[model samples]
Each structure stands twice: as structure tokens, then as C-alpha cells.
Target: MSGNEKISELDKVLTQFNVFGRYHCLFMFWSFLALASNAVFCSNFVFSAEEVSYRCKDEGFGNDTCTNMANSTAECSEWTYEDPNSFVAEFGLACQDWKRTLVGTMHSFGYMVGLLLVGPMSDRLGRKLSIVITGMLGGVFGVARSFTSNYWLFIALEFLEGAIGDSCSPMFILTIEIVSSRNRLLFYILCSFGYPFGGVLVSLSAWKFTYWRTFLRVIYMPALLFFAYLFLIDESPRWLLIKGKKDKAIKIIEKAAEKNKIKIDKTLLEKMECEKEKSVNFFRLLKMTFESKIILKRFLICLVWWTTSTFVAYGLSINSVSLRGNKYVNYALTSLMDVPANFIILLSQNYFKRKAPLITSFLVGAFLCLAHPFLPANLSWLSLIMYMASKLMSSFYFTITYMFTSELFPTYTRNSMHALCSSLGRIGSIIAPQTPLLMHYWSGLPSLVFGSVSLIAGLITFLVPDTADNSLPDTVKQAEEIGKKGDLKKPAPDFVIDKDKDCSRL
Candidate 1:
């Protein structure tokens, strides 16, 4: 058989097992739990580290309740927070604005480190093991974070939580690898929903528990549950196949077929041949990503879009605390926007493909964000509406970017590229918490920056190729070829397998 024919046969064999079976559903359940846990942990600080009404301690102050201290010139000798159990109250981070931002910054920095470490680890070790280890470690650290009394120890635990908790990428990659090509996009959309769902949980927890430590304990509880369930899931068959564990891969496929109630001839498994395993170190993956101009172009475009999406999405989310209203309602509404965002993507992905929706989302989100500063001071309601709209649109942009970037790369390098882009994207998140600080410079400066970057990213979205309905490429060379084809004007049809012919051959 020709090389192309061999690749086609492999794709056919892989998709033969029902992708939407009970097994796949079980996998997605575990994946969503992990994803949502990470999301809650990531956003929990928005509430936990919130600044509360504080006043300086002085002899003249009435029971640590100094009124009109906002205009006071006296240095705060000691601070008393409204919520005595809040991080600020416990750590005395009041008046030290940098420390407040550092709480989030450290988490993001750890997330970047996790991405860098976990990506290569996923490639070297199986995806399931990597997630299990990281998930358990993240859970441990998350629980530990609640027990820390020392400020620096809390910061270190937060860093560890970010490092271990942010293993969403590997779990995501595993979901993609396990499902059939036609069903991949649907699963991706479903998985992306977990993030906002997590955000909603965070808001609800904050509303229920006024104490930060208690809230931390609540959000981290899911991780422990997820860790127990991790043992029930199987390793990705594709990963096993690639690693030359043919017998193990065949058994997984057989089990999936059995669970899905499909009867297949055992002889068909004998036809499968493992490809020569390449040494896929980080440097080799990096070299492969940039060696082709088309791939390089796509990577650069995606990097910008991912970075901008994360920046705007996280910025708007974290900045909700500063909005003029009940912070709980503002946060819950912002997080709930993901529901419509996911619906819009699912509804529009077929008609708009990848680039159109992304561009439109970015443009709309940018307009709303940019218009925030110009709204009348008396029209706070309108300002809130604009902020919610911006959040919705940014959420839409963020969700689709994950799908788009996944489709742009070949299977072998997909996780590596995703990790790299996500790590780079963390720069935006790291900067997002500090954006509220920018309000000190100008009331609208942060919004202006977010809107401007999103606008530029929208323009760059035009350069990205559409991979709608296309089969995933198995090699880097094939990926380059797909990129060279540019925007797919016509949707590719799904791969169909000839069961009778395969059975006869077997």
C-alpha cells in the first residue's frame, strides 16, 4: 500500500469503534470534572483575595471602625477587614496593592510552568498517568493552601496549585484523541463548557461562604473526587498505539466495542501496524513547528489570538469585582454567559466555520469593551450591560480559539503546540489581574488596552486557515500541506468505513 493509503487505513480502523459510546461518555465525565476543578481553582482567587472595607488601627479610632478613612492621610498602623477570614484580613495584605495582584500573578506563573512541564510529559508518558499525577498533586496543594497561615507559604501553595491544577490541556488532548474525527468538535465544545460551569460554582460558593478558607476547601473538594474516578478511565488507545503497545491498544478497542455493543472480527486488529516511534523531545517538536513557513504562519496567528482571548476573557472576569454592583451577581452573570457563548459557537460553527465567528466575536467584544469608558456616569446600568456583553463575546472568542488551534496542528504535535500557545497565553492572564491596578492611571485604561488588543487579534484572525470538517492530519508534513491550502472554502466530508471489505480482507 502507498503511504497515503496506509494512513487512510489507520484512520479508518481507529474510527470503526463507536466514538459516542458509554466509554467515551465516561471519559468525558472525568475530563469535565477535572477541567471544572481547575477552572474553579483558577477563578476562586477573584473572590478569595477580594479587598474588603478596611480601616487603620489608632487610639482615636472607634473600635477599628474609622469612618471617612478613604480620604485619610494617616498611614494604617494595623488594618481590620470587614470579612475577618478573608485573605486580606488574615495576611494583612490591605493597603499593599501589589501583594493582592501577586496572589493571582503567582498562580498564572505556575500555570505557565505547568504547561511547559506537562506538555512534554504527556508526550513521553501516557496522557492518563500525567493527568492522574498532576490532578492528585494539585488537589493536595489546593487543600494545603487552606491550612497555610504564613503569607509566603500561601503564595508557594498557590504556585503549586497552578502548576498541578492546570493540567486541563492534557485532559483535553486525551478527549480529542479518543473520539472520532467527526465527533471531535462536539466533544471539544462540551468540554469547554466545564470552564464556565466551574466559574458559576465559584460565584455560588463565594455567595454561600463568606469565609475565604472555607470557600477554598469547598472548591478543592471536587479535585479529590476526580482523583478517585481517574482510576476508572482507560488510557487513550491512540497513545498506546503510537507507543507500540499494539496488544494493549487492541484490548482497549475491544473493550470499547464491547461497551458500545458492536461486534467486530478479531482478525481486523491484526492488520494494524504501529508506526516507527520518533523521538519527540521538546526541541524536536519546536523545530518541527517552525520548519515550515505555512505552519509557522499559522502558529504565530494562533499565538496572538490565544493570548488576546485569554487576556480579555480573564481580565473581564477578574475585573468584575471592581464593577459597581453586587459582586456576586456580576460574577455569576459573567460566568453564566458561557452558556450562551457555547450555544452560539455550536450553532454558528457549521455556517461560519472557524475564522468568521472568531473575527466577529473579537470585533463585537472589542466594541463593547472600548465603549465602556464612554458611557455616561449616571447610566451605570448601561455600563453593566456593556460589560456583560463584552464578557459573553470574549467567552465566545475564547472557546472557539481552543477548537481552532487544535484543528490547525497534526496529532503528534498538537499537545506540544497547544501547551506552548497556552503558556504564552498565560502572560495575558498574569497581566489581567494587574489590569485593575491600571485603573489608578486612568479609569478606562484597562478596558482600552483589552479592546485594542482584541481588535488587532481579530484582524489577525483572517490569516488563520479554516479546518472545519477536515480530518486530523497524522504527521507534521500533512499539517503543512493543510495550512498551505489556506481557508477551506468547502467542508470536507466524514470518513466512512467499508465493514464488509475490511472483514473479508481480514
Candidate 2:
């Protein structure tokens, strides 16, 4: 059938059962998995601060008991301080900051590459394929980090792990694409809360392991489980239609309708033989994402939001020296706060419109980040409080961004835009680790910078149209047309409307 007939059929089915009500559960389940997939990395923090030591003997020293001398200082007393990467250290390279940064940079670079491919690939091959490929690869690479003794191999595998694991971007696109418009924002926000919760899990696990390599190995096991579960999933109907696979789209829709106990029109099948399939080119995809006026506007706003959110969230986590009476205490406290952050967005979201919460949350984060630096160093508790508040606020905005972007573009462009935007967000994360190094040169500079970035992000939010009141866009042309009209709150274009009354569109 034609696109119009398909939409009409889908709408008819939607009317029988509240599209939002029946499908929200499915989307929520997928979102939970997405959270688990992304959080595995964050939860490794418990092992981040554990101390390790080595022993050695004195050669020509004054002490007669040369064998009693330790090779390295456990405290901050040594000049060299254990250069794990030095030729003498052998297996110690994993402990060095430069090595970690290099590994991290490589990981970020992989996301940069994955972003370009995964998004378009999702649009072309389907969200299910993209998720399975990336999630499975991530699982394989994530597990490999545990077995390697070679430093170079570990870095390479970790980089591959990052690239593959970051597939959550496409997964989010897929999850939101299948859900109704009404619950989209809430689902996005709630699903996003997984990042911090993942951090909590990492912290708990790493604390148990107390060694970075072992911690890395143990934390990412969930991805394998998630990969196994993907076979049970159905492709996005909207994506199916975009790819001209109307029959497959209808089959899934009918199955969903039957599963939900709703009926669909039998005649809809008669109208299925519709349009010629158009092959999408890479330049067109790139133009759709980067060059179009509509996409450029979305890209800029998303970039600002992603960069500021990442920098603020990570900066506070890294620089908040006052969060704990000690490091472990700080890890526990920060991890626990994620639970509230997750639920707060879940609760406050139904009561408020999307725009206000996002703007307010980000601004609040900026305030907390700024305040953290000025509080007296002696009053460390106050600093910790500020950091926690900042974290809560950052989490709120971060959740909103995902939902917002998922809805902003049409299925033809959603995965592409989401991936590129998320990739840019990783760029911000890569920039985040270096903030501490910058702060070492001038104390308080990092917070001030992060705070300023947050403020800017909050302000730029007004530039885009609010999605709190509309259905997701279903076509690139519709998105462009809507952008041209300069009305974000206008009723959705004809393309997104559902036509069939029975749940049989499956």
C-alpha cells in the first residue's frame, strides 16, 4: 500500500487501543535495556581509586637492611610515583593516566566513526540489525579487556568496546521510534537515568574487584545478556515503511495489535502495493544531517546541549573533591543520588511540559557547578551538596535531550541525526577528562568554565521548537517543511497520522 494508506491503517489500529498505553510498556522495557547497556561502563568506578604496590631492595643505600626497602610509595612521597608505562614496569602500564587517556581518546574516536555508520546503517538496514551488530561487538570487545596481558592489545580492545557499546544511540532511536508521541519524552528521560544508575553499578562492582582490569571485565557482562534478548524484538514499523518494506511492517503491526488484543482492518492488506523504493545516498544522508537548514538548527542546539551536559556532569564527578570524607564515600554517595535523578525526571515529567524542565534543570546545574568552586575549602560538605545538586539537574537535562532529538527528526533521518549528535556529545566527554589537568594549572577554573557552558546550553534551548506538545516527525520533507513554517507546536504533518482502527496493522 501507499504511505498514506499505511499511516491510515496504523492510525485505525491505534484508535482501538491507546497507542501510547499499549506500546509504552514495550518502549519502557527496551529503554531499560538501553540503560543497562550504556551504564556498564560508568559502574566501573568503584575500582577507580584502589591502591596497588610493589616491593624492591636497596642497592648502594646507607641502610644495611637493603631488602626491606619498598620499590614504590603507597602515599604521595615518591618523585617518579610508579611510571607503569616505563620499560621496567612490564605489566603496570594499565595504571598510568596517559595510557587511560589514550584508551579513552581511542574509544571516543570509535564513537565518532560509529556515529556516522550506525545511524545511516540503522536507517538503511533497520534499527534491529544496527543494535545487534554493535551490542554484540561491544560484548565481545568488552569481555576481551579481561584476558589480555599486553598493554597495546588492551587499549585496542577497549577502543573497539567503546565504539561498539556506544550503539545505545541507535538503540534509543529505535526504542523511541516505535512508541506513541504522548509518552516519548518521559520514556526518553526515564531510559536516560540508566547512565547514572549504571555508574552506581560500576561503583559497586569496581569496589568489590578493587582492580581496574578485573573491574572492566566484570562490569560489561550485561551487554551479552542484552544481545541475547534482541532476537525477541521487532523492527520499528515506521522504519519498515521508510525502507519500503510495507508487508514486513504490516506483519509486525498486526502481531502487536493481536498481542495487545486490538483488531485491525483486513482490507488494509489489499492496499499494500504502493510506491517505488528510493535508494538513499551517503551525501544525501550527510546533507540531511549536516547541511540542511532544518538539520543545522537541530545539530547546533543538540551539540550545545550534549557538550554542556557532558562537561557539567563529568566535571562535577571528577572535580568534586569534597563529595566524600574520602573517595569511596564519595563514590557511594554519587551513585546513590542517581536513583533519585532517575525517578525525579520520571515523576516531574508528567506534571510539567518538556521545555521548562529542561531549561530549568540545566540552569540549576549551572548554578550548582558555579557555586561548588566558591564554597570555602574547609566546608567540604557544602561542596559535596552542591555537586550532588548539580548532578541531579544535569541528569534531568541529559534525559530530555535524548527524547527531544528522537522526536525532532523523521525516521529517515532520526538514527543519523541521533548518532552524529551523540558522537559530538562524546567529543565533549573526551574534552571533560582534560578539565582536571587544566584546573591543576589554575584551581577553580574548570568549574567556572563548565558552569558557563551549562548556562549557554540552557539559553540555546529556546532556539528549537518544543516537542512536548506534538507527535514525532515521520519524514525528512515533513521535518524541513515544519522548520520552514517556524512553528514547532503545530499539529503533526499528515505523514505521521495513523489510519486503521483495528490493532491489526501488525
Candidate 3:
């Protein structure tokens, strides 16, 4: 932590602006705004695409819900929906659970492709363009979706918006690049509240609007306004400096300082511009990984960990709305659980070794979920308690694993490896929507699968190396030697491309 080389030159200059920082707060607010909109955008299925209760007219069974019509041999051509305002109600998807859940699966498919294109585009084009373009298009598509009654068109829009419009990852990178190193964790923790806040906002909006089309248009209204971000915020000066746009980067810095009512010297900026990052070739990294025993073992293990984490985290989120209670309250509670999990991760960063907390959280959470189906029918409250507690545990390990994956890899290939694991991890989300369909097979089947995956993920943490207190490894040698008793060199750049974040977008 004492190494001067570990701090980037841009970070040093930005430290002056971090005090009495109006500019910092202003831009960070914009980032969270994107996050908020992104939350409601990704979670539309919780209300709109969920199965609604309905009764169909049949000669043998009169006014019985489709779920209650399980054993009846009668086919009902006409039906009455209890909600009158969900996708199921309009599309006649009452008896078809998989069709009801297909919207969520399609959305996840688009999100996976978006994550692939956005990161490199943010590097090549500017953050402002990425954020603004994606935001505007996402809104356009979302608003367009409101006018559609065809299920095929609705799902197509879902895919289009996801692939082209997700802006949160770019916004997240912009925030990290602009803020000083010391405040990164605090800034991230504060801004992270946006997702949960957005979830509550969605719940309230849906409750008030009561119609899927009305709710869809209402949330996307704010996204159309993101075009202002093009002029309102500065391009990340750090990125500009790295990309050799010194004059533009300097102008941004001077503008930031001027807005903060401070002065900066021109010579200082020029001096810092000379620092260069090592060029990374991803193809070479593949060769290096195969040559190192520990590195290869670590990468393979990360595949499992990342996949299981996404499966459990997102599966629980989807299940929250399906729980036997007020659906809004269930989702709000599950979303809010992430707030404490974020803070706990920040607090524990200095106090404990990372492995124990992660392992314990996954293991204990799995046990809670495993016990969810055994309680008596009268003890609904206890069952709810177990479900919520399990979600809390999932939040803990889910947040922690982002950092843990970064710590496990060598610097030159870290971003590439993280991206690979995350993309594959999308498989978990791809399958999560179908979990509700599992209930038709057995009531307890979904919970059993969630707990079983969590248990396997928890047990596998013992196989990979622990990275607490060790300097970040910049080479295969250092990565292989992680967790050994020694002071390793911090050879990588101070700034890392942070890939550990909400799987909702990236």
C-alpha cells in the first residue's frame, strides 16, 4: 500500500480536486442515474412477464384457476384473468409458464452480447458517446415496446435494447476513471444504493400504474433525457491522457479545477503525461496461462465460481416476485439486502482475509435455502425469513466475488480473463428464468437447485488461492505464487478495468 508506483500519475493530480469536490459529486450523480434507469429496465419481467392468476370457462370445471385445473381433462378456450393487466392476461399465457418466462431469457441473451461490445467501444469511442447513444436508444426501444401487443415484437425490442442500449458499464468506468484512488470504494458504495432504490421505485411505479404498458413508458421517460450527458459531463481525463489526447485531457482537468474554484499548473499536467502503460496482447496471455500450473488451475476454477454466483444471485432476484406474499414487498426486501452487503464488503476489505467471508456466506446461505421447503404451511413467516436470509447471503458472495476474480489473475490478462468468465457466467442467468417452471415438477425443486449450486460454489473456494494482503500479481509467476508468505511486486498500472459488478448489465 505504501508503494508510490502503485498510485497512477492522474490519481495524484486528481487528489487535489477530491477536496470540497462539487465536480466529483456532480458527475457521480449522473452515473447513478444511469444505474437507476438500468435497474428498472432490466427488471421489467418481475411484474410484466410474470404469470398471472386466471380462470377459464370449461364445462367440467367452472371458474377455476389454471393451476387448479391441473387434473381436469377439460380444455378452456375462453378465460378471465384476475389481474387484467399483465402479459399473461393479454397474451393468453395462463397455462404456459415457459412462454411467460421467455421475455426474461431473451433480455438476458441481449445483455450478454451488449457486455461483449460495450467495453472495447467505450475505450475506442468516448464514454459520453457510449452512455448517451446507449441511453437514448434504450429509451427509444423501451417506449416503442409499450405500443406493441404482439409478444414476438415485445421480446424483439427487449433484445434490441439490451444489445445496444445498456449504458451502466460505461458510466461505471467513467466514475472510476474520474474519481481519486482513495475515494473509489466510498463512491462505489454510495452509488450502489441506486439499484435497490431503483427496484423500490419500480415496485411503487408498477403498483400505481397497475398496467404493464403504463409502467414501461413511465420508467423510460428519464432515459430519453440522457442526451444531456453529452454536454453536461466531461470525458474522463485519465482515459484521454492514456489515449494521447493530451490537449483535450488537459482542457478537461483545467475545466474541472476551474469549476471547483481552484487553479492548476500546466507544467504538472505535461509531466504526468509521460507515464505509459505496458501494451497487453491477449493472444500471448493464453500461451502464458497454459505454461503456468497455478494460473491455469485458477482460471478453470473461476469459471465455476462465476457461473454459480450469477445463477444463484439472479435466480433469487427472479424468485423474489414469485414468493408467497405481496410481490412488491418481497422484491424490495431482496433488493435492499444488497445495501448492507455492499457496506460489509467495504468494511471487511481491511479487517479480514477475503476467502473466509466468501466461503462462509455461500455455505450458510445454501443451508438457509435448503431448509426453505421443510417448514409447516402455517409458518409462512419463518419460510419467508429463510428465503430473505438466503438472498442476503447470495448478495454477500456475489459482491465479493467480483473483487476476488480480479485478485486471482495476472494483470496483463486480467481484463480478458474476467470478461471470459463473466460472459460464460451469463449461462446462469440464461437458465434462471426457467426456475419458476421447475415448480410444476415439484414445489421445492427450485430451492433445492439454488442451494445445491451455492453449496458447490462455496466448497470450490477452498481450491483457488486466497489473495488477501498480497500485492496484485502482474505476471504468471506472481499469480502462481499468490497466498505464499512474501512481499510480491505491484507491477501493473494503478488503474484496473473493474469488471466485477452487477451482472444485470455487465
Off by over 4 Å in 2: 1-27, 42-96, 265-277, 288-291, 319-322, 326-329, 336-338, 346-352, 481-506
lDDT of 3 by residue, 1-506 (tens): 22223324555577566422566567667776788887788787778776677777654445645533456555677888888767788887867777878888887778777766665566557677888988998899999888998989888999888777878667766665566644454566556667777878888888788788888899887789999998888887756765568889888888899877777777667665522224544456557766887777777777777777778877888888878878888888888888888778667654555688889888998898888878788988888888888888887887667667756765444444555566567678778888888887988888899899889989988987666545445456657777765645333232233343212221
Q: Write the per-residue lDDT of candidate 1 for residues 356-405, one digit (tens) a residue.
A: 89999999888988989999999988888898999999988988888788
RMSD of each: 5.1, 6.4, 5.7
Estimate the overall C-alpha local distance difference test score of candidate 2.
Answer: 0.63
For all candidates, the clash counts are 0, 28, 0
* Strongest candidate by lDDT: 1
Which parts of model 3 have CA positions greater than 4 angstroms off? 1-7, 14-20, 62-74, 258-268, 273-299, 353-356, 404-419, 462-506
- Among these predicted structures, which one has the highest TM-score? 1
Please provide, for model 2 over 205-285, each residue's C-alpha lDDT reduced to its tens digit, 9 standing for 90 to 100: 755775565666676666776665466678877677667787897888788777666677768644533233356685686
Cand. 1 Cα-lDDT: 0.77
Rate residue 314 of model 1 by lDDT: 91
Ranking by TM-score: 1, 3, 2
Q: Which parts of model 1 are misplaced by more than 4 Å?
A: 1-7, 13-20, 59-74, 265-274, 485-506
